[model samples]
Target: MKKVLLAVFVAGGLAFSADGAAIFKSKGCASCHQPTADTVGPSLKKIAQAYAGKKADLIKFLKGQGKAIVDPAKEAIMRPQLTMTKNLPQEQLEALADYILKYK
Candidate 1:
């Protein structure tokens, strides 16, 4: 029973983490945001560094409650991306942030 429960927990973590990658792809974010290099928008590593120790703020930004910090000039370009994200449930947004944060 304990082994079964442990397996479930590990599986859950993997599943939740996978959502982050999926969200990035499905949201069309990769067009402008690369994992390690900047494209039209800032890179994920830059975003992670900018939001270091402030994951909650990052999540808030995704929710359309915070402002752009990494690429203010391209805020307009990134703004449209938020529309796709603003409606996502909180957990998914956190997962997205988690994936982005991993770049740091």
Candidate 2:
């Protein structure tokens, strides 16, 4: 019984961890920000590079607390998108940040 419960817990955690990319897509982030090439927004690689070694800052930015560092000139375009992310639960926010940072 204990092993079964442990397996269930681990599987749940894995599922949650894997939701980052899904959330990014479902939230329409991929509309502008592609994995490698810049479009309306900077590519994920650019964001990941800008945010490298700053996971907490990345999370804060997603939460609408931190300022944009990847492309301050285009912040106006990205600012409104925060509304979609600002209220996410911490776990989801962390997952999103992890997903973005994975490009680095």
Candidate 3:
């Protein structure tokens, strides 16, 4: 049987990528977080840098299973947003993390 392709990219070989930027936009994340600016929330660059090589922890945070290491002061403000991310499937979470990490 031929494999069905959703979206494919070549990393080491063939790979799949979810549209994380689309996810961010559809989820209304851009309303608070910007690509490089600190608005109501921290910038994607800041988060990406803080979580560099720490994609697992970032996933945990997205799943509502970790603390805010980026900006503790804004934890309360960011908490509610976790509900939006916590229920995402593994693939989507990885995609989201990948998208954020691209800024690093």
Number of the predicted model whose lDDT against the real structure is largest: 2
lDDT of 3 at 102: 91
lDDT of each residue in 1-36, candidate 1, tens digit only? 999999999999878655899889987898888888
- TM-score, prediction 1: 0.84
lDDT of 3 by residue, 55-76 (tens): 9999999999999999999899
Q: Among all windows of ten consecutive residues in candidate 1, which has the lowest summed lDDT?
A: 13-22
lDDT of 3 at 33: 89
lDDT of 2: 0.93
User: On residues 9-67, what C-alpha lDDT tens digit does candidate 2 reach at each position?
Assistant: 99998776658898899999999999999999999999999999999999999999999
TM-score-superior candidate, 2 or 3: 2
Candidate 3 — what's its lDDT?
0.87
Per-model C-alpha lDDT, please? 0.88, 0.93, 0.87
Top-down TM-score ranking: 2, 1, 3
Top-TM-score candidate index: 2
